[model samples]
Target: MTVYQLPVEVTAFARWLTELAGRLRPDAGWYGVFAARDPEGLRACFDGAEILPWDVVESLLQDAGEPADGPLADRARALYAAAATAHDRRPGGAGALAERRDLMERERRYAESRARELGERLRAATGEAEAAGLENDLAWVRDDHARAAARVTELTTRLARVEGHARAEPVPAAQAEPAAAPARTQTPVRTPAPPAPARPARARPRGARYAWLEESAEERAPVAVPVLPTGGAAPRGARFGGGGDSAEAGGPARVAEAADPAEAARAAANAVYALQRLRAQGRSGEAHVLLCEALNGPPDRLPALAAELHRAGLGADWSTLLWEAASLPPGRLAAVAGVLADAGRAADCDQLLRQGVARPVEELAGACAALHAEAHHREAHALLTAFVRVRAPEDAARLAGADPRGLVPQLLDAARAVSATRERDLLHALRVAGLAGA
Candidate 1:
């Protein structure tokens, strides 16, 4: 028995065949082995797998009985047709189409304008020879214009057909196959995979406090955020320590130890700003990891750092970072939660509330209001109800006091659902105050 290694594409094709046929076939295994040795040869045998040349694949699928008219068959036929068309147009088809359309339009306009100029010249000719010459030139211009217009029309029709096929529903397999297959004489050009582009160095202004915040002239750099090690420790050499010092002792550490809090805050702010730039450049995952470093650093500077992030339009990214960290200090948790809620990420805000319920009531009130204002009534109801159930009656009362729009009825419903008598009683007091419906 001849052993054969299958390429990834051939394996995928076999899987697609199995799905379409609703049963595995021995031939699929053979095809997989056959494809591994000669993908180009297999493609040739199938007469170009680009369009509807599915004669070979379809024969294997039909072995298990013609596939029932279902989503599987419909999708397979449609995907096959699309794959063929895409393969045929792989050489900058979209860009080429646009450029051709523009060129034809310009040519048509120029020809029309030239014909008009020649017509005017023909009228001004003083002799029959000049008049005849001008008329000939005008005729040539008119013919060119006509040809350009016709070519434009042909291209427009072709483009419409291609676009229509793309948008059309998948055809049945029986209807999908061509009545007569076209000859496949041309060999496909195997374009080499392009190398990854390097990130360009960005120029920064002198004395700029947060140079990373300035938009770079080059394409955004791809930054992979390093995952925190187990036990939630900051990565080695991460500069998140207080007094602008990294925990790892070094020259910068020696200098940071002597720096004032103001200088430390500025350094920390710049680091956070760099994370923001990463987020802006579509590297949110990496930025999130770097942001977690801040959480492990100085807890005291979190509010100021979060505020800076908020000002830079990265409130959503910061919310995600804070939520992922899940170990923020109570003060920083409340501050970040408020920012998240204000930014309309009520889900993250709710999680924060659940984690930091021990924080001062005053600090939690803004987030609660933001949730309520955004009509995240369910989350707000649950958070408040949980607080009422877990905290003392006075703390729950203070929470109720913050509810100017009267969420007592919603809280009562939540309390009743959970069978919490204390929460029910607390809501009843607010209901008695006419803040809730009877």
Candidate 2:
């Protein structure tokens, strides 16, 4: 419970768990799972993540024989005993539940028989006064019978539901029930519902485009790569549209177009909030596609969409959004990045500045060149400046490994005709990154 106690508990617990797993027979129905898992790997997972491995303990309580005979065996048995006592104390413990069901059945049967006997007595009564007394007694018995029958039915249905669910899936490893539950109640503690199997993560997503996603991959289920929605695949009336006339016509458009952009951004939070839910539900593939389309959509919509997503919170997904945001045109790109910063995504902005993740070197050069040819000096400087400031060494190294891709000339050309004063800071950062001169 205290920080000082954690290290000791985790080490001992992992050993006890492994020992129990190793001792489990094939008949215990848990040998296959333990055999498949590397003991060291399992121990490492426990140590690194402080999650109480209630699922493991529950399985051991259910089917694992016990700790193998050794020094740890005594400690393991003590733990099992404490947990077993708690388990039985819970309102719906295995043994207690059976006993309660039996008691309820007997109560129901007795109530029904008493009601039937009282009814017969009422029917046999001769005098009006006697018949009235007998009828009153019969009515009370009937009510008791009905109440008992209902209670029995409810208990039976609840038990059946719990058993059916237990068969369908094992408890989630993250179920929060402590070894000692906080409260015990008559209402049964329902089993933790297991999630459905997820699609396997794709090999390709761990490459360049999705490299940033790998940082905390161990903390979550492997997210599968998303298949971008095609024209036909797009929801016909999807509230969150990607761009253009269709965006203007969609439900989300009305919200984004509100008189108060801030108010609209707050309201539009649900769009990204839904994406968060999808990922939490292990539908990361869908979440990935939705994010790319929304954040990197039409230039006109980028600021509002970015605001909405930032408002809803991206959890540990800043990299994904910045990757998608990288493809935005220079002006829209800067605007969206600022919105992310203002909405408390300053850390994400820092990542952009450092990594320039998903920065397409050739694409940026061409876009900046087009701006310069049009005599938009400041804008050209802004574009290149943004890229240089986000000095991703990996990207530069990637360029170095294969081809220069006109890096020097691209920087030179972008700097020409630009207002020195207006773009001074950008030029300095660019120079610092060795991509340009003062």
Please report, in order, the local distance difference test score of every candidate based on alpha carbons.
0.47, 0.43
* TM-score: model 1 vs. ground truth: 0.25
lDDT tens digits, residues 153-262, model 1? 43443343344433333445565444544674443333334876876676753322332232343533222111211112221111211111122422110010122447
In the predicted model 1, the residue pairs found to clash are 50-84, 225-286
Question: What is the TM-score of each predicted model, taking all chains together?
Answer: 0.25, 0.27
Query: Would you list the clashing residue pairs of candidate 2?
Result: none
Please name the candidate that would achieve the greatest TM-score relative to the true structure: 2
lDDT of 2 by residue, 1-438 (tens): 635333433444555565665666644454345335545545553453322233344445456444332223334433432333333333354555456657766776787778778888888889999999988888767755645544444344334434443444434545534354457634334464487666655454332223223223333322111111121121111111221222232211111121255534543464566676765553444555565545432223434555555555653344455644544433334444444444565545444432232234433443333344334454445454444333333333332222233444444343343335424544454555555532
For every model shown, the clashing-pair count is 2, 0
Worst 10 residues of 1 by lDDT: 249-258
| Candidate 2 Cα misplacement greater than 4 A, ranges | 1-267, 296-313, 327-360, 370-438
What's every prediction's RMSD, in angstroms? 24.4, 25.1
**lDDT: which candidate is best?**
1
